[model samples]
Target: MRLWQRTMIRLARSRTITDFMHASRLMRPFSSRFVGGGDAGQAVATAQELAGEGIAASLFYLGEYVDSEKLVRENVDALLKAIPAMAAAGLPLHVSVDPTQIGSVLSWSLCRENAFRLARAVAEVARGGSHPARPALMLDMEDAGVNRETLQLYFTLRENDLPAAVTIQSYLHRSLDDLRDLAAEGAFVRLVKGAFAESPAIAHTVRSARNASFKAAVDVLFSQRARERGVYPALGTHDHRMIDYAGMVAQANGWRRQDWEIEMLYGVRPGYQRRLVQQGFRVRLYLPFGRSWWPYSIRRVGETPRNLAFVLRSMAGAAG
Candidate 1:
């Protein structure tokens, strides 16, 4: 990572600063840019609104690696509660949960239980035909340290015939192999440039290198036989060049629009997202909400230096 990105990542990781930003209204304008709301209600409402606009929604309850079983239960309950509204609104449910946030901080058994509990809930909602078109549970990949656990949970759920997906961070040296493994299991994969800061040994320290890794990962995602398992590779970057490249690569391979999906954050580049949808591409907007928005907002800024500067300026403007 560049020195500035490293600094931003450190700042974003600080709980003290995150708390301060959340407590003050001065950051609302900035936060509002990336976060749908500060609660579940607003998130669903936003998703409903997006549905009206012909865009798909993916709900992510804002939280991080959780240590307590009680907290994990609460998170699962909250997700279940969000489902009714999502279903009622006629929105296809795309449930995303962080295993670390659920039980990573606890023992391995606890983590497995927590993940299984989440899978059960997803299966329940999925049973009612509430979202027949495409209903899935996404296992949000965190730092590379938890790669083994994430892959294990994915395999465990897959073995049980659960409707599941796994996110792979291209920046990690091990992700290519992970992608190949998940492909054989017919798992939906979200290819992200990765958000966490890592050492050069395991991840690229430069933006260009990371982007290159992401492009290569996409090649792997689409190279699989779509006729057999149907690859649902979600490109999670806002870079127009990468987006254009995705279109070209898909076309060259004779893949249709539904073969892959474009995933973007809730509030980033709405116009561009719309244009993609307008062009007949499947676009899923990741609508994140809840009282845990602070950390998420910080991570958004930390992902790109330009986003951080824009947020800082917006916060200052809001204060003024």
Candidate 2:
């Protein structure tokens, strides 16, 4: 890591800093941008508000890397609980799951099994299209380490004919080939310029490289056969330039406005998100909730260190 990046991570990891933000109501104004709350009710309610505003949502419970089967079961139960309320509200909601949150510490077989079980449940709900209220489930991508198992489980569902989506980060070098292969077979791709910290051997560190790689991957996703696999690309970013580029790609390819969606983190760039929605583009807000917000919020700040200054300013009542 560069000297500045390393320093930023250290600042983000400081217990004093994290604890204060977690304990203070002063931070709520900023936290409200990204995290719904630490509970299902708050998250669902927030999602409904967004739906009312013509924004779609992907509800993510904020927790990961659970070591016990019991905790894993609880996570599954949480998602199961979320389904009915989201359904009843007629909200545009998608269920996002991280397998590590369920059973990463368990045996590998058990971990895969837990993911499969979750996928099956989501499949069951989605296949209930007759109900007209079921939400789509997306298997979130973890660090490069979990990519293989993630793909295996995703393909298993494909074989079983379970309809689902997978997120792929652009930072990893191998994703170029991965995108081509997956796009060939058909998959819904959520393209994010990744947020995790990783060693240089596995991930590109320079913003330029990451941007180039991400754009290349986007090109692959928009290939001729994309729409056949329901490959409506979800551009998971807040950068205006990248959003403009996606618009050009859509126009060049003659893609319907519905064929692509812009996704933004709940608390970042609200004005930009609103403007895009007003322009008739589908917008999906990543609504993350739960007590696990601390770690997730830290990662977000670490991803863009300038955001740390913004958070501190928010704590000081300086920014909205």
Candidate 3:
């Protein structure tokens, strides 16, 4: 990572920076530009709006690192409510969640119970025909620290017959292996270039290498073995090059647009998303909502230097 990106990542994780940004009215507009809203109702409404534009959405309630059961329960409750709301709105939606946000950091048992509850709720919602497409319950991958536990939880969900999905970071060296294993299980997977700052020891620290890994991983996901086994892949990227490459790969493999999906953040590359949809590609927007958007917003800004203007405005607001 570049020095500026590394610095921004550290700041993104800092509570001091989070407080400053959250308090700055100047940041609200930028936040709303990316974040869906502050609650489930607003998020579902946003999803409905996107659906009207022929875009599917993956709704994420943005909070993580829960150290309390109360917070975990609250997260589950919100998801339970959101599932039905998205269905009622007739929006094509996938629900993404952080395991730690629901109690994975507290205890494995707590996390397991909470995950099962949310998955069961989603299953029930699907059965009711509220979400006819049977939108998946996806577990958003965190840093390397929780990788094993997150994967365990995902497989456990599948073992119990829950239609679950897990994310794999292409930057991580272990991701290739994880992809292979997930493919063997016919599990749904989302491939991202990774967002967290990490040591070069475990993750690809170079941009070119990471991009290469991403394409290689995509190839593995769409390999004949994986496809025949019914392993679905979701390509999460906004890079035009990567997007075009994915389309080329699909075409070469004679895969239909519905066989795989291109996932992008809700606010990033809107025009590209529209163009992809117009070209008969399946696209899903990652829509994050909730009051705990500070950390998430900071991470988004950290990932793209172009977003630094919002941070500068926030800092200026604080100084003034």
lDDT of 1: 0.78
Q: Which residue segments of model 3 deviate by more than 4 Å?
A: 130-134, 310-320
From the highest TM-score down, the ranking of the candidates is 3, 1, 2
lDDT of each: 0.78, 0.75, 0.84
Which regions of candidate 1 fall more than 4 Å away from where they truly are?
130-132, 224-227
lDDT of 1 by residue, 220-278 (tens): 77763642566678888888888888777777777778877889998888999898888
**lDDT for each residue of candidate 2 in 1-320, tens digit (9 for 90 to 100):** 35555565565556687677678787776676569866878888998888888888888887677777777787877877776667667665477888687676576677667666766766665555543322457788877788888877777767777656788898888888888778878776788877766677888878898888888877777766676665668889998888888788777767777878888888887888899999999999888887656666766776676777867877788433
- The TM-score values for the models, in the order shown, are 0.93, 0.88, 0.93
User: Which digits, one per residue and each the tens of the lDDT, describe model 3 over residues 1-320?
Assistant: 45766787677668788788778776776678689988999999888888888888988887788877888888888887898888788875479999888898889888889888888877877777745444688999988899999999999999999978999999999999999999998888999999888779999988899899999988888887888888888999988898788778767777678888989998887998999899988889999988777778767877878877766775576557
User: What are the RMSD figures for all models against the true structure?
Assistant: 1.9, 3.0, 2.2
RMSD of 2: 3.0
> What are the runs in model 2 whose C-alpha is more than 4 Å off?
1-30, 127-134, 317-320
Which pairs of residues have clashing backbones in candidate 2?
A: 33-267, 38-290
